[model samples]
Target chain A: MASMTMIPADCSSSTAATTRLLPMSCHKGKALHFSRWVSLSNRLTASSFPSLSFKARASSPLISAKIVIENAAKVIDGKEVAKQIRKEIAVEISRMKDAIGVVPGLAVILVGDRKDSATYVCNKKKACEAVGINSFEVHVPENSTEQELLDSISKFNEDPSVHGILVQLPLPSHMNEEKILNAVGIEKDVDGFHPLNIGRLAMRGREPLFVPCTPKGCIELLHRYGIEIKGKRAVVIGRSNIVGMPAALLLQREDATVTIVHSRTKNPEDIIKQADIVISAVGQANMVRGSWLKPGAVVIDVGINPVEDAESPRGYRLIGDVCYEEAIEVASAVTPVPGGVGPMTIAMLLSNTLSSAKRVHNFR
Target chain B: MASMTMIPADCSSSTAATTRLLPMSCHKGKALHFSRWVSLSNRLTASSFPSLSFKARASSPLISAKIVIENAAKVIDGKEVAKQIRKEIAVEISRMKDAIGVVPGLAVILVGDRKDSATYVCNKKKACEAVGINSFEVHVPENSTEQELLDSISKFNEDPSVHGILVQLPLPSHMNEEKILNAVGIEKDVDGFHPLNIGRLAMRGREPLFVPCTPKGCIELLHRYGIEIKGKRAVVIGRSNIVGMPAALLLQREDATVTIVHSRTKNPEDIIKQADIVISAVGQANMVRGSWLKPGAVVIDVGINPVEDAESPRGYRLIGDVCYEEAIEVASAVTPVPGGVGPMTIAMLLSNTLSSAKRVHNFR
Candidate 1:
């Protein structure tokens, strides 16, 4: 896998800013909030190689990288689109609260103390607040028993005030994810990762209560951009349940001929090259090169990996599973790592919470 | 669709009657099940097509379909395969009862009374008895309340003796199928049509407790016949929740690049012709013409339709969704109607019942 030049952290400028939404006694700056603020600079290799310096160029009037930035940049702009959706949701939330005595509530359980999981939980909470939704955060220790977790679920199930429930993933290895998840009643499964909802989504003539968040975000990007899905050949690289698998089903449901390419799949790039639409969710950073994307193909990169960055104080920067540099030149549109699918997840989660509230209240 | 010929009610000397399994209630005489039965004659049409037949011929002497014979037979013997599965299940049931004081119990609920639904219900009961599985039948009028149905389900759910639950499908339009089916707790969902289970099946890493019966039956035939599934391109027609949808997921789970064609899909025939394996569950008789199949493609037809036939006493003949006459010439292997996927459904249902019992008991 090609590596990117380490970008220097502009830490001096970023002061400790407090976001008023988090009134909780405990919590830090939004952790999982995708911070893929890539800037275009002649300050280039002053950052590392395989250089990621060009990944996220600001939305300027000048379509800079006029030659280098073609497909990857054009394929998608998840951050901008996600921000738009978040704004729309904010309006919707304000309307709900003003018109009806109701506020969407999301209860998230963070089991054990995996740094990544913790970061994800934190970002989710912050994102929840930004949309005017209330978030109930529960931190369970690593040694928590199945019964204890199940008990917490029961509490959430009865808490009519909580409209959606999300158990931050990668629970302790000993924990049975399925059992804990099944404990969440179907009505409040806002993540839409439940088997029942999945089945409905996978099958014909049935709609899931909520599409799986990441995949849902991908489809939303397409819909917002008015990309026609029907009769399109969509190739999804990776087959993870959370992303690849559900993404393929979602695309297929929209009438795309979806071929899911996994680790065992032979010729992933060849398969990808044939696609009119490509969604790379495999966690391999910089794996999909520009050559892999067909010109004019729409791309949704769902990977968020930490890569080494000597210039940044954190010693590393976040990059996507796909190699966006060459990709931007080939694909018609694409989403950047930090700003793309990253922000979309929380936005979708908020949307789902709002939706859960709507359904619970029979708000049509 | 081929027409059915009827011998006089008492004229049991005809070939189909001699070879077909008699109903469990009429099994006073030793009878060969679907697989073991010999095919006296599978020809009812002109001999232009090659590989299709209504039943699997069991005579050792008829090892392979002779070019002449293949040219004549236009059926895919689902009835025969289904018969074999039931006999196999019956033997296993007997063994379980003898060793563990356990008898698989399947409870079926029928609401409102569609004539076709009634016939299916009756057939399921007979199939259960034949397989040595106990059957519990319940009938509710069309006007029954959702609560009343839920109460009955609760009763069944609480009944330790009841191992599986199947609500006969095509319930009154007023009844909410999703609510009713989801009410059947996942553990007792014997038909494997439960949304939760279906969702698991669709997710890449997740496996359902039990695959839906008809789709399971289709796979069973492939397994019994030693058909290779991994790394094959399989096309599934129709997208109905009951069959086409789940069937495609099951196939994809088995490593096939599955492309699903639904009612809204255009150029389905062209899509299907590209498959190494084709499973059509659309329920439209003869909708899939022989020309639609690629040469040497393996076909599993899950459609059991009753087409009008003036010559038969019932004034109708059982036909499949495939154009058997033309398909036989093109397909390397194909399922036959009357005896094809129809029989497998009941066998799988029985198998699912046993599976449910084992799961509930946590029997390894």
Candidate 2:
């Protein structure tokens, strides 16, 4: 097992300088290195930890994913389980298409390109195609006005082909993210990232048409892995509304005691050690080390960061916030980064798109 | 300290359930409970808890209203604080009346024949008169049609002076809460318990004009007490959207490592013992005990339950989920049942009403 070259010391996540600018150093120790982990847009942070996802120690075959996959088979099979879900969605989409002549359509709008957003969009498009749904894409320049972006949203809002509309996040800074995202009509909000959908998702009794993709992916991973969410001590390390917030809510809804830790939380690593399930959504790569994970805890890493990797042809590879090397040895079961939440997110987006199409086309 | 009685012997609210429920409990618990709570309009289940509020405990010194009141002096004198707020609203109302011949009016529609609802309506009316705001009450028979209720909401929605309209909750068993609540136009939804308000409350960069009164009242108390919410480990017990859900969101917005525990949560009592601050909104009398609270954590008890009390002339006394008798001895600060959150709830409702009027008239 290649010992995770990534250590806890690798990341001195920059201090959170925004907002109230709270100093939580009193929480752990007073080594006050401000973390610039927060960015104007990008959240993807870990690249070097990419290979660690499947094989923890490059030298230790005992901790490799092949064994973890065999152990997890007694509980869940992610690939087969995901296949079953996609199949159900496909059947549903076909049923909707035959009934209303409406192939559930998902229009993904990508504005100004980040590589990660491009990859996500491409995967979403491919997922739609795989599920027998229509996929539409509109690539607008990075300097697009809020009005222009809204106009595009309006077009999708009116397009009967568009059952679910998703705009790849981290939109160019000049574009107001809130304004553009909110413009996607609630009925067509497949990403489930819109406030309206989020509100419905957060509230009781009201069901959201679309649950946010990442959290949805996390839950699907747990379900297929047979990781029980009810009555568990689950700690989510992140506070972004799109992932951490909804993930906490979803966990709570299942009757788990959910704690959301962020840059402001006191002794975050200590808090993570208490969880029976630890979900690290913070974008800082390798922030959640093996010591932070409770032994035998289920680990779901939602981060996909690009770290400098000279050995790779692309010069960088993706990794999760969790240090996979340490986590696999300590965790009873864990989801590997690229093949873990990544695929599940795209799958859920497709499912949401099909669900939205079914709702709009009135196909029961 | 009094020993806390466990609900279900098999419920390891301390560990087993906590592990299994951390993910699904929060999102599902509240909605399911809200649905069950509101569905009584359709049918009553023996399983549902009583609607007895926390205010009735005012007469019991064991509940320690004065002690909470005493400690709260640094932050607020509720009586004085509430009086000052009312005075501000009165002055605003008088100014509006003289300048525009407009006074803020609140219309409350009471459905069915619940004496408690009648008493609550009476208290509200008195509060309105005390604040110089016009109060209108409409009592309807238990068998009122859904359309009739919708029509009333529509009428209030269009009414000019009636800036805020609240249909008393726990509406008749025959009404669909979502439909009925949604009918109360978002602008006039002063209670802030509406799904839209809950959603807006949940999101960042989006603030709801009116936060649900009880949760907002809790925040007001903390704010008045000069308690810093940012970067705290705050645990919210119960998952009701009206109180717990909104409270957690508000706390998180302030950057708390927020955790929500409920019926299915494993070892919830143990989970809560880790909080720096605990807000219990589970509506169970004395569910949160001193042992469950961190030594000096601030305790905000939102439960207002009626328990059999022979000493009281009413034959019942109201108690909060936190055993005030024990919490005060352990917690550095805590809210008592009667005077603590009770006065604040109505106070906030009045404040919200004025806020809605101000928003409508651009008074601020």
Model 2: per-residue Cα lDDT over A1-364, one tens digit each:
1122332223333322211111233211211110122112122222201222323324355444444333221111234445667887888878776776778888889998688788878988887898898889999888878888899889999998788888888878788787788888988888887776777888878888789988987887776544677888899988777888888878877778888889988888888988878787877777787667766677888887777677779676777788665565566666665556766777788888877876766678
Tell how far residue A207 is off in model 2, in angstroms: 0.9
Error of 2 at B280 (Å): 1.5
Looking at model 1 chain B, report the run of 10 residues with the lowest lDDT sum.
Answer: B7-16
Residue-level lDDT tens digits of model 1 in A1-364: 1234442222211233211212212111111221222222111121121212334332343553343332123434566667777888899888888878899999999999788788889988888888889999999999999889999989999999999999988778888988898899899998888887888888766788988899999988777666678888788888777888889889888888777777655566776886778898877667777666766677788987776678779788887766665555556666777778887888899889999998888875
Candidate 1 at residue B16, lDDT? 25
Model 1, runs deviating above 4 Å: A1-73, A204-207, A267-274, A289-295, A306-318, A321-326, B1-76, B142-154, B204-207, B306-316, B362-364
Off by over 4 Å in 2: A1-84, A98-100, A113-116, B1-80, B95-101
lDDT of each: 0.72, 0.71
Report lDDT (Cα) of residue B338, candidate 2: 61
The DockQ scores of all candidates, in the order shown, are 0.35, 0.54
Residue B78 accuracy (lDDT) in model 2: 40
Per-model TM values vs. the true structure = 0.77, 0.79
Question: Which candidate leads in TM-score?
Answer: 2
**Residue A52 Cα positional deviation in candidate 2, in Å, after optimal superposition:** 20
